[model samples]
Target: MFDVIDFLQTVGQDAQWRHADTEALAVALTEAEIDPELRVAILAGDEQGLQALLGQDPFCCLINPAKPDEEQEECDGSCEEEEENDNDKDKENDKGRG
Candidate 1:
């Protein structure tokens, strides 16, 4: 996953925490080092530089939906924990009956 903080610092400049801007198309030219050419372009608001930078990465440009309904059903962890707790309770009840 991309580091949102780094990208925000790149554009927002000294943004304490929040950095994601859906409207602003941030093109990541390098993973670790921000290219001098790109840095100059961002500071100067150079249109051509922005255009050129877009060509550098394809997958990074697309804006993902705010709430991806398709993947909402997928549980990260909390839901699994709740399911496990319910199973444990059921197992205990079964042991008592047995």
Candidate 2:
């Protein structure tokens, strides 16, 4: 997990306007760190909460977007499982030869 204080400190060093308010943000991050559910909720929002917390626009795919692939889900590594089976067969052949 990214530490909010460290993130804020880095932002403070890079931007002048940020340096002034990062101290406050650091304190807010302490509370945010303790409450993971709140943090997840905040991260799930579209823009307003993200802009306030991260100082940038949030582009969440869940919000203000079209459903491009409602039916299609990403394939999990089933192909790799098949490849591993092939490897096991090769190992068995090697053992027979030895």
Relative to the true structure, how large is the alpha-carbon lDDT of every model? 0.58, 0.57
Report the number of backbone clashes for model 1. Answer: 0
> Looking at model 2, which ten-residue stretch has the lowest summed lDDT?
34-43
Q: Enumerate clash totals for all models, in the order shown.
A: 0, 0
The digit string of per-residue lDDT tens for model 2 on 28-88 reads: 6565563444344334533465455555655657555547766655779998899999999
Residue-wise C-alpha lDDT for candidate 1, range 1-98, written one tens digit per residue: 13433664555664532453422343343544556566557547676765576464424456667575555455579988999999999999999999
lDDT of 2: 0.57
Best by TM-score: 1
Per-candidate TM equals 0.27, 0.24
Q: Clash pairs of candidate 2?
A: none
